[model samples]
Target: MSTEKIPQIAFNPKKNKVLGVEIISIENLMSRNQKTDHSPEKAHVLKFNMIVLFTGGESEQLVDFVWHKVSKNTVIYLTRGQVNAFKFNKNLKGYLILFTNKYLEKQLNALPQTTTIRLLTSHLFSPKIEIPKDLFIKKYFHLFYKEFYKANETHIDTSTIHHLFVILFNKLERLKTNQLPQIKNTERFSIFLKFKELLESEYAKNRNADYYAKELHITYKHLNIICKEVVHATAKQFIDDFIILQAKRALINSTDRSSNIAYAMGFEEPTNFIKYFKKRTGYTPNAFKKIHS
Candidate 1:
């Protein structure tokens, strides 16, 4: 006569509303089950305005162009414009730090390029440091979590939270300095960073390597050499990939007509856009929307 009970599914990040630092929790964000299956479609798309920290569990084999796995006692920073997916096991326990771009921008506004904030922005989406599983890092993480929780509870007084956040940033910066060695700088690396920044700003209007070269004050040949050296891809390939990424984002986030989207993204005509998109993605824009939707 006894009825069998159904098992509960873990909390899904995709189903939840985006919360800022003022109203989020580490425990509340995680699932009770250690092992959970997640599809790429269920991956949480981080809107560019916020930062998030996640720990524990191996991620699902989803397509991630820019994802990083942190070591124990390490904190991974995800700036704007990067997306990733995760699959957590039961022992996955970590704090997810959420903050706004505006929060960091204010401080960075006064700093020069060599400063930590500005340099960090340039290396955004690139994992830079790996904190060891030492007592110092453990204590810092604990303090960060405590201060973050206190900030969430005292949501009305942001001044207190700001101070706490500054402390957190200082600790992270110290760890970054002490734990990680500097990566070698090369001409190709410098060019790649410049190209990435330019691509972010001008991907809609300019897809040609020549145009990027003009902006960077370098010849097209030099640009190509640099890109090939650093990324092992041609400048055209990088542009194509950037365009495809934008197309994918538009397809997922908007319900705009295809023609409008095409024009908005700098295509001369809808048909041309369709052709280019299909060539890169193997699906028409409409088809892409349907598949992702």
Candidate 2:
């Protein structure tokens, strides 16, 4: 058997639908797999944002190559560029809300500035939010489903859907904050967020902490202090972890060979890349690919 390269799934609105948002039941989505040709069981990199709320069933979902146990009230937030694959079981019942980054950004920009909104925009934190029988979440999802797919509507009222989406994110943000209290330091977190934005775009070209510090307009020591305060890792360690994660994602998600991946990731010599990977992960690139493949 051979593995397929993880696809880059883009957000394409359906016919006559102007809104970038779509909500569908898991059962309906799985049933259309054959016609749609995009099975949930396979891994793919997303080009948009997604929120999957599992209202029933027990299964594991793969996010960024790691499997997470999910059950009732488990909400998974998958942002753009993350690798995602769903384990669809017959008994699983849920709702998937898919939207474009542009749609989400526009709604976010219209909202007031707050820590919760900031956290929702920043992708530096965990993506899972487990709500234990929360009534508000249940009601919100129910209401959203009714409005999103209501019959007799000539066109979808995107404004209403956007408001529901904001409410959902705010609730998820509260839960995430409780799970990660260190993000409460608004000042440090703001700087750290900027650092992360820079790292995401420039990690392939530059892995040096000094470069990021210069881009953030802060001294190296100051950047390190902020990194430690927010994520409990030094600036350099954070950069290494991020790049290694990107490497791991590429290794498993793509069919590219180690040497090819090394060159794409800015390594001049594949041998040096192999050595660096081994030092950080205790496994050669080929070995890691074998284990994860």
lDDT of 1 by residue, 39-117 (tens): 3224335543322343444333122234455434445555445444444545555555555555565655333323343
What tens digits encode model 2's per-residue C-alpha lDDT throughout 106-137?
77754445534443444456678888684469
TM-score per prediction, in order, is 0.62, 0.85
Each prediction's Cα lDDT score?
0.57, 0.80
Error of 1 at 55 (Å): 5.2
lDDT of 1: 0.57
State candidate 2's TM-score. Answer: 0.85
